[model samples]
Every structure is written in C-alpha cells, then in structure tokens.
Target: MQHLSVARPARAILLGSAGLLLSGCSLFQSSAPQAPLPASATLPDATISYTLTGQGSMPVVFQSDLGDGKDAWDSVLPLAEQQYRVLAYDRPGYGASRKTATPRDPCTIAAQQHAMLAQAGVKPPYVLVGHGMGGLYQYVYARLYPQEVAGLVLLDPTHPDHWRRMQSDAPTSAMAIKARRKLMFTSIETVEFDAQAQCLQHIDLKTPLRMPTMLLVRDKFGIEELGSVETLVRSQEKDWQRMTGAPAIERITGAGHYIQKDNPVIVNEAIKMVVKKK
Candidate 1:
C-alpha cells in the first residue's frame, strides 16, 4: 500500500477564560507519557488514549485534524457530553495510541477506526464528527460503511478537489501544500499519503447516508489568493451547496480554519442537531 504524507500545522486557541475556549488537539506524545488508555476491551489498534465524556445512544466519535489528539475539542466536550456520548482519540502514531506501519489513506484510516470502535464496543447509530483533515476521513467512512454512521459534521474540511487543482497547474500552490505537509510531519509522526487512492473517490452521499450532514466551515481558499473573508464565503458557499445538496449548511461567523475552536457553541450546536435528528 502506498503511504500518504501530510503536514499539518499546530493550531491552539488562546483567549481569556471568559467565553468558552476550546483547546488545541495534542498531536504528539510518547508512550512513556502515561496518558489514560482506552478500555481494554477495544481492539489492539483502537487502544488509544482519549477522553470520553457525555451520555446518549448515538455516540459521537470525533476525529481531529492532522496531528491533533483528543484535547482539540476540550471545551466542546463538556457541552457535547451533556447530550451525546462524545468520543475523541489520537489516531495511530500521533498521541498515546500505538503507531501503525500501514498507509493512512482515507479507506485505511476509516476501516481501522471502525474496527477500533467495534472492539471498544462503541456500537453504531453513530454521529461522526471530523475537523479539517478529519472531515475528509469521516466522509470516506460514511461512504464505506454508511449503515454505521448516523450523521456527519465537517469543520472547515480541506477540499480534495482543491488539493488536486493545486497539484496540477499551480507549482507555487503545490509548494504551499508541500510546506503544509512538512509542518504536519514535524508536529506528528507515522502518517501516510496515497495520492492515487485518495483522489476524490466518487463519494455519492445520496446513497446510504440520508442522515443529516452539517458543515460548519470557514473559507480556506477563494479563487487565486487566500482571498478576503467575503471571497472565501462565496467560494465555500458554492462548494457547500454542491457538497451538502439536500442537507442543511450553516455558515458561522468569526471562525477560521479551525471552526471548533473559533466558537465551541456553533460546533456543539451542529453536532447536537445532527445527533438529535430523528
């Protein structure tokens, strides 16, 4: 299997304790750190250390962006736990979880995570939440195993189309992608990239996941330049329309690439709505 290589920068939310402030995801930690491990009943690969808070039937499994671990959604968990069972963990190789030698492509990651969830006895009727790169994984997961997934929440996910577009004609743009990849590697380790396998695999959500999908996103790129917020909004608006189609989409104000940290309330509400849906 071809390995995937990606570099994600470390993002942390910094503000006084007044308003709700979500923390950065902890991407790197040695096995020596002695973090709390998942229940022993989980599969060997799923034996990741994570914080599980909340209560409910439809368990919400949150996947963090490149390198980020469970802490990424610290603030939001309190509220989320109040309604649904919130489960977030470090993907293999990043946090306290055991690293894997296999490629970290969408299918591989999704399958492995699914296995882990099963081993841990976290049954489906699940509400999957993914931030940034995590969003991409959840998308693939729903496509691969739609019956298990109940809903999806994507927080400013990186568009696979955008990456492909940059790689084709824009050498300069590709450089930016490369730079981001480098940053991701430095912050975390043992990640793989299979460009061939991951290049927009005909995701027709119209099939299995008739469930609600809430995309709480910020404009990552617009036209040529990073573009103004307006441009980003318009650009995201078009993509959002195409992506969600029948599903509802909400555009939150004042959020950046990391929508969860930007405003936990928005993230919480989006997850709440999707999980609450009958």
Candidate 2:
C-alpha cells in the first residue's frame, strides 16, 4: 500500500477579460506571460473551488498536487489556453475548497472531481494534466471513466505501488519516506496522505490505458531526501509507461517533483502532444 505522491509545485495561467488570448510564451512562472482573466472564469463550487476558461469543444483539465490548488498552475495556464479550453480546481482542503468528512479514497476523489466539472457544464474527452497526488487522482479518474479522458500527462505522479516497491527494494528508505511525508508535509493538507498510500494498492498497476499518455519524472527524483532510492525508483517508474500505454517515460532534467514549475516548457509540450493526438 504505497501512494507515492509526486509533490507538485505550482500551476500557471493568466486571466484576461476576454476569457483567453492563446499564445506561446517562455516556460516560467515569474517570467511566464500574463493576461488579465475575467472574474467569471473562476467558479467557487459548493465543495471545491475551480477555474474554467473558454468553451472550446475540447477541454484540458489540470489537477494539482495534494498540497496545492488551482493557483499553482496559474503560470502555465495562460500558454495552455492559447490553444484549448482549460480547467483547474482546488480539491477539498487545499485552497478555498472546504474539507469534508467523506472518506478521501481515489475513487471518491475522482467521482467528486467529475461531479464538479459536470456541474460546471465542462464536457469530457479531456486531456488531463496532473501533478503529485493529483496525478494519482487523475489516473484513477481515467480508469473509472475511460471514455471521458482523451489523454493524460502525469508529472512525476505517484506510482500506485510506490511503498511496496520501496519496502521490497529499500526498507530503510521506505521508513525515511514515511517519516518525511508525515513530518515535512504541511498540516493543512486535508487528505490523509500517509494513510492513503496503503489504499493505492487496490488499483491494478497493469491496467491498460486506452488513451495517449505520458509520465514525466523529475531528473533528480530522490536526490533531495532519499538519494539511495534513486536507482530503485528509476527501475520502478518503468511500469508507468507499460501500464499507461505511453510510448516512453520521459525525464525532465533540471526539474524536481514539481516539473511543471521547474521546467514548464516540457510540461506544456507534453500537453500539446496529447491535444494533437488523433
């Protein structure tokens, strides 16, 4: 039972009064281009807070890490919207979204997210962009509703069998990871992250992904804390491609767990690739 979270950094998007002004710009948050977004683009839901841009036939959905919200993608959204409609949201207890007593399992979270977008009138056959645990959530969403997802871009997503692999491959590193997740993670995180790691085991890692998919991993995956696991992690990550039907698992050099914020150009290009898929 290991739900290894990707631990994403931020989401990028610029708000313009006209809903969107799509254009390519450099991949950066501070230096990323900006546009004035209208107030209506933001929709505060009864359970979550989400921002939806444009009404294009196709939709690009952005799901953030467990600790972050839609604002995390603010820097990248501007560029993405230049070509497609996009949606970003705050899962319960992350941003303005309130926490609930509901059990925070992958299935429950996926269903809730689906309901949120459905209520917003956002159609599916979507290109999903997810980071960290958000990556896990989006993956589950695609599994539950295969017809709804057109493609997937997972940014260092939690490999469903993270803990098992760690324990089997490196026991000491697994303990350290457990302690780090419990201690270093902020208190406001609504999801019981450590506990959920076990639940991820329920998912079948070999389940074939019907849609085009890519797994983007950070170059120095475990250097920051557990350097020893680097070798083991690289080996384990290979399964993500096999499971998702991705051509290859790509690595983002000079990037951390939050590949979107560290090297957004690659992330954007991946999204573009999915969008362009027939």
Candidate 3:
C-alpha cells in the first residue's frame, strides 16, 4: 500500500521511535505571516492566527501539536479549508499567540484547545485532524469533549504508552526515548520543555477514547538497523487498534514517523471518508 515518495535519515533528531526517523519537511514556519484568515473567525490574543474556511455542515479544526502553529500546515490547510469550515491556530509560545500559563501537554493542553476553539466560535460535531504531537491533544480533546468531535484523523500520533514504555525499559522504550531526546533537542528549547513536561506529567492514559477515529501510521520496515520498521509499525498498529477500539486502520507504505509529509493523499482521503460517512 506504500505507493508514495521521499525518505531520508533525519539528522535533526527524532522524538518518538528510533525507527520512526524521517526527513523533516519545512513548509511555513511560525515566523512567517499567514494568508488572511476568513473574516467570520478572528485570531485572539492567545493565538498567532486562526483561520476558518469552508462552509460545510460540520467544521474541521486543525491544531498543531508542537505549538509550532498553523503555519506548519501551509500546504495541506487550504485544501481542507476549502471543503469544511476549517480552523487552524497557533497555540501560545510558538507563533503569534501570546505565551500564557497554559501547558502544552495532554490534560491542560486539551482544555486550552477546547476553550480556544469555543472562544473562536467553532464548536462541537467537528472533524479533527492532528499530526504528530497534535495527535495527543486530539485524543485528549475527544476524551474531554467526546460530544464535540464527529470524526478523527491521527497522523503518526504520540501515545502515552510510547512514553511510558520508553521509561519502563521495554523493547520499544529506549527508541522512544532516543526519538524524544533528538526531537526535544532540535525543536524544543530548555525553558519551553520545562513547562511542556510539567503539563505532560498529569496525563493519565487510563481514560478510554470512544470516538470514531482513524490512525494513519507510517509503515517503516528496515529503515534503520535498530529495529525492523515492520516490527515498529505492527506494534504501534496493535496499540492504536486497541486504543481507539476501531477495526479500521491504514498502513501508509514507505513512510516513517511523519506520515503527513510522506503522503498527504492518504490523510486527505482518510479524513474525507470519515467525514462523508453517514
């Protein structure tokens, strides 16, 4: 099923699995000025920018995981924004958004995201698409406001087990730690991480998610000698299948941790399917 392109060893450091490394794609950075947002919605002081496009019955809000902001999704947002009333915003401390006391971890980050969406006048019955760390917030969002999410699309998301196993000396934990250290070193600053880690500490994975969701995992096989990409994908596949309790899963071929960069077509298709379903 992996019928796409682009794969290079990520020298910039990885944050999850050692086998999950990828060639980081740079699109829009937080420093760039975004295109004008839809007039119907406005960017508050807490966010760098919030754009709402599309006029569908249900709204799709895009949230960046690392607080890198909506600019990171420059390539993909317009496509989705045209179809649904899509909303994308930069969380505090990253883009034009104000640096607030809010933490970027699961529980507090989830609450902040929900509150921001509500304040922006974007509400429940939404189709949420999150990538990487954003996947964690999406999970927390769905759990916190189950009634608000209509469909979910997770692109190689981060799971609590991914971190827990890393610290537990499990076969997968070491790689997860390496990935995190690499990523944390490259993207997150020391001060930012202190706040981020504090918020992440309170998240308990015992909460079960019941929303209809699709997890698009990069199927990396033998990309690195540390572990077989096949084994990595299978392990994550089992975890996601159990976590979401959804029988449907898509194995994106020839992709690493960043599936969104590997192939946006898969993500677009998956989101459309979930949103279009009756």
Best-fitting candidate, measured by TM-score? 2
Model 2 lDDT per residue over 1-278, tens place = 11223333433221100000112223454334435332222223337767777445778899877667787686678777766788888777777777666667777778788888787778888898888777778898898888899999987776666656666776776665566556665554524464445445666667779888878876643333345466655765687778888877787655566676666667778887877773
Q: How far is candidate 1 from the true structure (C-alpha RMSD, Å)?
A: 9.2
- Ranked by TM-score from best down, the candidates are 2, 3, 1
| Pairs in steric clash, model 1 | 3-193, 4-192, 4-193, 5-193, 7-181, 7-184, 8-184, 54-81
TM-score of each: 0.74, 0.79, 0.74
What are the RMSD figures for all models against the true structure? 9.2, 8.6, 5.6
lDDT of each: 0.59, 0.66, 0.59
Ranking by lDDT: 2, 1, 3
- lDDT at residue 46 of model 3 (Cα atoms): 43
Evaluated at residue 142, the lDDT of candidate 1 is 80
lDDT per residue as tens, model 3, 1-278? 22223443322234433223444553322233335563322333244356666667778877665535676566566566555777877666666655654444566767777767777777678888887667767776777678888878887775554544434434454565455555654343323333343454454455446666777766653323234433444576667667766555676666666665556555666778778652
Give the lDDT of residue 178 in candidate 3.
54
Worst 10 residues of 3 by lDDT: 1-10
Model with the higher lDDT, candidate 2 or 3: 2
